[model samples]
Target: MVNTSFALSSTTRRRLSLVIGAYTVVVFATIVALGVLSATASDHAPRDAWVHAIIVAVFAILLPMRLRAASRGSLAGLRAIGIISGVLFMVNVVESTLSMFPVWMRTEMIVIALLMLVSIGLVVRERL
Candidate 1:
């Protein structure tokens, strides 16, 4: 049997790691920005935005790394982050929907959350 399976080369892995790390940094920055912007709005504005920002930060940190690990045939990281990220995303969506934000932002969040779910499904199919 000619085992034709291939793996990502070390150089490719390292490059991808760098890009993913940069993406993570950008996501974290957005979270911080949201929190800071929230503080200037109104009484409930900061609270809503900050809460939304923090949960999103949690999702932002976990999901990408977990998905990366899953793609390499490891279920451990995926299991750890999948449930929590999914829950946080859903909670954020629901809370944001109920909060003082405009309907458009709430809709955007729902779309983001759905995309996260799709990623989770891909991870499960690929690595588990």
Candidate 2:
């Protein structure tokens, strides 16, 4: 059910935005780092890293638009952000477990997952 009456406070909304922005920065950084490592890393397939980076890049780009909508009190926007955050969390969890990337990258993935989890929680709890 859509909770039309639910509205995020400015502080809460800013927190959500911060989470989203931080996630985006981390994601782009991951992509850049992956690209740099892909040049010399022989332990993992460059194709896999590139694919993951591309997918995350798309999500990172989409977030600001969704945040704008949510900030405007659009329920669909809020739901979209929550859903994206949850999906990214799961993706990062899986990535963190893979042996394909270096240990440091995997650790970064763990950090990304945690951040996404926080974002998801913020969106979900506010809606609730």
User: Which candidate should be chosen as best, given TM-score against the real structure?
Assistant: 2
For 21-77, candidate 2 gives per-residue lDDT tens digits of: 887888788777776766776454366767877888898899889888878878888
Residue lDDT tens for model 1, 24-86:
565566565565556764443355555665656666677567656745745465465557546
> Which stretches of model 2 miss by more than 4 angstroms?
1-6, 40-45
Error of 2 at 79 (Å): 0.6
* C-alpha lDDT (0 to 100) for residue 111 of candidate 2: 82
Residue pairs of candidate 2 with colliding backbone atoms: none
* C-alpha root-mean-square deviation, each candidate: 6.2, 2.4
Ten residues in sequence with the least summed lDDT for candidate 2: 38-47
TM-scores, each model vs. reference:
0.56, 0.85
| C-alpha-based local distance difference test score of model 2 | 0.80
